[model samples]
Target chain A: MSQQLAVGIDIGGTNTKFGIVDRRGNILCDGRMLTNKHEDVNCFLDELHQHMSVLIEQVGGSENIKGIGVGAPNGNFYNGNIEYAPNLRWKGVVPLASLLEKKFSLPTVLTNDANAAALGELIYGAARGMKDFIVITLGTGVGSGIVANGQLIYGHDGFAGELGHIIVIPGGRLHPGTGAHGSLEAYASATGVTNTAIEFLSTRPEVPSLMREHSKEEINSKLIYEAAMKGDPLAMEVYEYTGQILGAALANFVMFSSPEAIVLFGGLTQAGDVIMKPVREHMEKNLLPIFRNKVKLLFSELKESDAAILGASALAWEMKD
Target chain B: MSQQLAVGIDIGGTNTKFGIVDRRGNILCDGRMLTNKHEDVNCFLDELHQHMSVLIEQVGGSENIKGIGVGAPNGNFYNGNIEYAPNLRWKGVVPLASLLEKKFSLPTVLTNDANAAALGELIYGAARGMKDFIVITLGTGVGSGIVANGQLIYGHDGFAGELGHIIVIPGGRLHPGTGAHGSLEAYASATGVTNTAIEFLSTRPEVPSLMREHSKEEINSKLIYEAAMKGDPLAMEVYEYTGQILGAALANFVMFSSPEAIVLFGGLTQAGDVIMKPVREHMEKNLLPIFRNKVKLLFSELKESDAAILGASALAWEMKD
Candidate 1:
């Protein structure tokens, strides 16, 4: 009998990417659609159904698809739902997997985006042969997936690996989403870096730099990295401070998961060594003497566009058994 | 054929505890001997061997023992060795498992003390039915054992779960053993609390306290707990502050492990709600909204005297298969 295919869907705040993949981690066909999170969730599901219909027609109808796997913010593997996801303004529990299964008439699974990303990295990217490692995505918010002994830790309620929200500072700046102070997300996310940079600029107005060239609306992590690369002292400071916090957070992560390596992904990580250097330094300084030089920290080898699709696909692939 | 029993050993700074345990987590026999870490390791092993011989003789000899499992300071499961453990003056990697195996002709396994405690808890204590949880022992130093997906995470070299070393404060006070500043051990250990209390007392000499009744040399955690119970404001402050730091640290652990519960064991934890109340409050305050109230922090029910022995015996029981 011929092997069946699985559909992988990654629903982000801005876009929805989907792919038909096989058990071998091969993507056969893929497509994307704009995500209108502002609309009612039913409307979002309707839109998803339309996209699925088109993809089914494109791939010689739905009979070849064996199942569907979804990766979304606040997606719960245990419940097959998304619960009050911050990015999509999802309120309460949305029965996403059930809805998808009903629409497509296939076995379905759903999990938080970070877990999917870690699965992607494990099945097809830098962590291919590794059983233990943490995949951290530094984007709008810091997200993490922890794999220990080759399995994702979903905890009791499927709400594990919320690395971004861990307090990096006791009474430092407040995180917008959680209103908690000193969270890694409050310091390491794109918005986090912006907040830190804004605070730094406010305190050191004398350190004139390219950050002043852009309107507050135009300022983002990319421009900050570019400005720092151009030797802007203020920009350098921003990256340095951000890296320090990231490193400290990673150090704490090391204590718990003890992954062989930490793979970093997303927009902010592109600052490269500007961010990695400080992280490594702080991590080494904080590590127990035995583990000081044992662990490695690396940038994610997976591309952003491919990562979500691959991760989603990997989730489907992992469910084959 | 009758099922065989396994031997479990826990080596600490002062003593070595060992027991013969069955697969069902029942201890058949137990023994203890001085660690004598200052002497040649071979001599220490010889002493351990003698104790084991007596136990085996009582149990109808070595053939009935299937394996030996050891939990020690700096014990490494991956390499089956103990390396540069601060508690032991031993300077090199001691092939502990192999040495015991060679001596007694039994299969042997090894892991750090904290991991052993976690495995023990998983098999016989608070986390017996749970697949994921963190077991933290607050004694001379803070140590943790992480259980994710029903397995202990030894990390790259069995050096994982160094919860005591994670830096709580950036450039904070110096730690006694590592000399690193701001480490959890510097502020949360018994020695740490005493130091902090001393610092607090010197600044407020006029404050009448029960601690004044004991000589500085005799002042310990038990005395501090007694004073706090008598409404000593300084003692209360010390515990509150320690719990706050502990709670903050646990908040970080929750993000990484996503464990259902964090079980606290050992001397410092004896303070019960005096430590747990502040820990819960600070943890809730620091946690992200989604994670708030999701994780439970509880004290260990295992008696301190029995813990190390039980944990080590549990390791033997777990490895019997």
Candidate 2:
């Protein structure tokens, strides 16, 4: 019980997951609650504090807790604010770290969720020993955290590592969230996969697919994955197309900072080889000879939410006095 | 007279430019020679030494010189070797750095030409106070050096920041040098401009322009610039096309590292607003709202070869004994 612990909160669009994580990445206790339900950020904080108090009390109290770390969409490390996140109900800049510090009476740190995941990778996952690597989260939308020389490239602004928004297919597909055309997110996210499946079914109507059984709304990445597992050609082709775009984007990223490995995380990675095969192939095909076959394409070893929680908590440990 | 100096050498595909640079970026003396005339690197070195010795003598000899820095295509900073450069006739790995060290008895450093140009920008040009920026050399081919957190992103391997080779268009245009299709180099380079003009003239034969005055063999970037200046619609459209592609690629690069600015260098940049206007427009159009209208697009202030030489020389000042 003497071991110091840090509180980590990952604020997602649908759910907010919080946990007490030790330095070794062990989660003593964790909980989740509805995020979008609280239209006001203050109400969200009140509910978050109420639930988190119980977890802190279980772990012996605030004295044992080092501090708090948060992972949120559009969270800025330099400013500690959540600035106009598309997924969040909060309209503008919410000084999340300051709000959390006032509530918990402890120091707090904040960064974008993808950056938090990258820090988690650096602390306890696949990139544990590696100095240069990129962690890409392929969930609701494509998110990436680039680690170069063992540091996350926050760019001149805190908004660096937006790999998903990069236009892979110039004027190809429109991203509903960003309103940008041919962004990697337009074709590689779960939403992107769903869109691709619908497009495929509509365009290639003669080519029968198990995906046809479900309505467009019911058709999702899981159904596509299941169809692929059952050897559905259309479903498999969907992944091939997605992977091709992703692989090409990855090649561009590799050339940018020449990382040691690219760790893919989130729901999309579950497709596994159905997706990984084309990603590896297209990435290698696009790369120059010097860069070819050098970067390791990998999947996240940690559980999705746990990785985010641990990653956020890792940020707390580095908080300065 | 007592000011310390460094020898800066820029090895281009056609010419090798060397100079004696003082600590404050002044080139006291400089000389150029044909790069591929000597098949043997040793003979090249001998000629280089013979020419450089006169400059060194003029500048008061080795006593005032700190070291030497060489910038060449495919020059590796980690291994201090030129590893299989496509442009250079010296095939395979050429240990030019060690050979220079042996020849001059001075500590030597080596990095790719673009990286050298980046360093030059950081030390003496527009990016003097900037910690994050990118330097793009739009010469025979598109070359780039990315600076992040006030340091060049050398990556895990020494060979990072090869932005020119990153594919902007999939299977769009074939790069004769790398056999890769639709590389940024395929459309944004000086050679790429020549190719685009040739392509435009061939495809749009119905269109009339000053470019028709020159034969296919005579048409080059200089001629295209000259024609575009005179309000030739076809030639102006060529620059517009080039900038559109370059701007789109810049947008992708911006998302990757989120640099403060992108400094354009080399011959093609002399087209000025004729090329820059389109690049700025397309880069903005392709970027996410968070990234749009933020990055400063500027021209390199340093003279082309001088910037590379100064940048390479700057590396010498940092070489540890």
Candidate 3:
């Protein structure tokens, strides 16, 4: 008999990614389709099934496949639904997992993208063999997935580990999404880095920044990282400020759960030491004495392009019969 | 055959309370001794064993007791040691569980006081049968114990769930105990309530109130609660302020772990609606939409005096061998 494989699917606003994966976390076959083109959830799933069915054939047919796992915005493991995920074309609650299972005729499981990312790290990346740790993704917005006692904490509502929405600054920066002040996401995300740079530039008109040459449309976290690498002081400060806020928030997270480590993933972490040094410094500075130096801060070893699909696939491997 | 019983011990700065409790959570006998006078942990353990031995005899004999469970400041469940606990008279690392086992000739388990309290609630109090919940103790200082996926999270270091140390207000109030500024403990504990009242009074000297009749030393949380009950605006404001801070912090907690309920325990909770109303309101106000109404804020049902002892005994009952 052929070795068992699983189908990993990631539902994004623009595109949907699906891959056939082996038990060892290898993506055997990969495929993608434009999500926005499919206005209906059923159309999207039908297209995904067609794409995945071909991938399974390439990897020696459905008999070799085990199950399907999905990761999307606002995915709920408890009900296997994606409820009010603003990014998705699906409106209200969509029974995504059941739809996928009905199409593919396989066991299926679902969870939020951040939880999938954490499981990805736990099964095949930085958190391997770790029983207690947190994976924080600093992307368009901050997202987190907590793993304790070798299990993902779905909480009472399958929406646990929303660390980004937590008010780290308490009435400082106002989050546009949640409308809460001083949230970690408001200051530490890609948009946050951009907001910080714009805010800093607005306050001091005389500061010579490479950012001034570009229109606001041209500015982003990637461009900011390039500017900081070129020794732009303002660009450097953006990363520093972001890291300080992130580090302080990380300290709070450490104190709350006392994880063995915290693994950072996403675009902001690309700044490396610019974001990490201050984060490490402030996290340690803020921790209670006993918790000091005990938590290992790490960067994700998983490749950014493949991480989401791999993470989603981890959920498939995790599904019990 | 005799009924199996467990010995529960709560070690505090002022006193050490011990009790022999049955499997059904009933106290067969109870006793306590002055902890500060002993000066040494060995002397303390010797006295505790001698005292507990008598309680064991009254319940039948040592053979009838299943095990011993000790809850102390800084207790490490993994190594059974109390490391550098500020409140305890014993200095440095004290192997507390081993000491009790050596003298008492019974298998023993150890955990921090807050964790024990959570276990007590899980077994015999408000958290009964709930899998995911958080217990926040607002005493002289704030502490917390987190239960997720039906087990107390003894993170990699056996010191998970220290919610009090989580920085709620960045660079805000300073915690004298942890030296971390803007920690939850610095703003929501009994000490914090007194300090807020003092700070409020210092800011508004013209406001005529009953608090003005007492010296700075006489104004405490209990008095503040009484004044709030009588509808003193300034005193009422203190509970509102404390609850606001606590509620905002609770919102963040609900986001992080998404616990089914947050059980507030200890002296500060005595203020009842004066605190609960604001805590619930602010918590909901700060929380994201999905978590807002889903998480319940509850007052612990455990009798304050017996909570510590009951919490410790629950740990013994949880032991596997």
DockQ for every prediction shown = 0.64, 0.80, 0.78
lDDT of 3: 0.85
Q: Compose the digit string of candidate 1's lDDT tens values, residues A201-262.
A: 77989998888877777777878888988989999999888888888778878877688899
lDDT of 3 by residue, B1-321 (tens): 453788899876567889988877888889999887888767777787788878888888888888889888778999999877755668778998988888988998999888998998998889999999999988866878999999888888988888888888888897766677898888888889999999988897776568988999999888888888888989888888898999999998898889999999989888888889999999999988877688878999988758889999888887896
* lDDT (C-alpha) at residue A59 in model 1: 72
- lDDT tens per residue, model 2, B1-85: 5538999999987788999998878899999999999999999999999999999999888989999998888889998899877
Q: In model 1, what is the error at residue A163, expressed in angstroms?
A: 0.8
Ranking by DockQ: 2, 3, 1
The numbered model that scores best in lDDT is: 2
The local lDDT score (0 to 100) that residue B302 gets in candidate 2 is: 91
lDDT of 2 by residue, A129-191 (tens): 998999999888678899887788888888888888888887788876778888898899988
In model 1, which regions exceed 4 Å deviation? A1-4, A22-39, A206-208, B1-5, B22-39, B46-64, B102-106, B204-207, B318-321
Better of 1 and 2 by DockQ: 2
Evaluate residue B48 in candidate 1 and report its C-alpha lDDT on the 0 to 100 scale: 86
Residue-level lDDT tens digits of model 1 in B221-247? 778888888889889888998988988
For model 3, the superposed segments whose C-alpha errors exceed 4 Å read A12-15, A33-57, A60-63, A86-91, A103-106, B13-15, B33-63, B89-91, B103-105
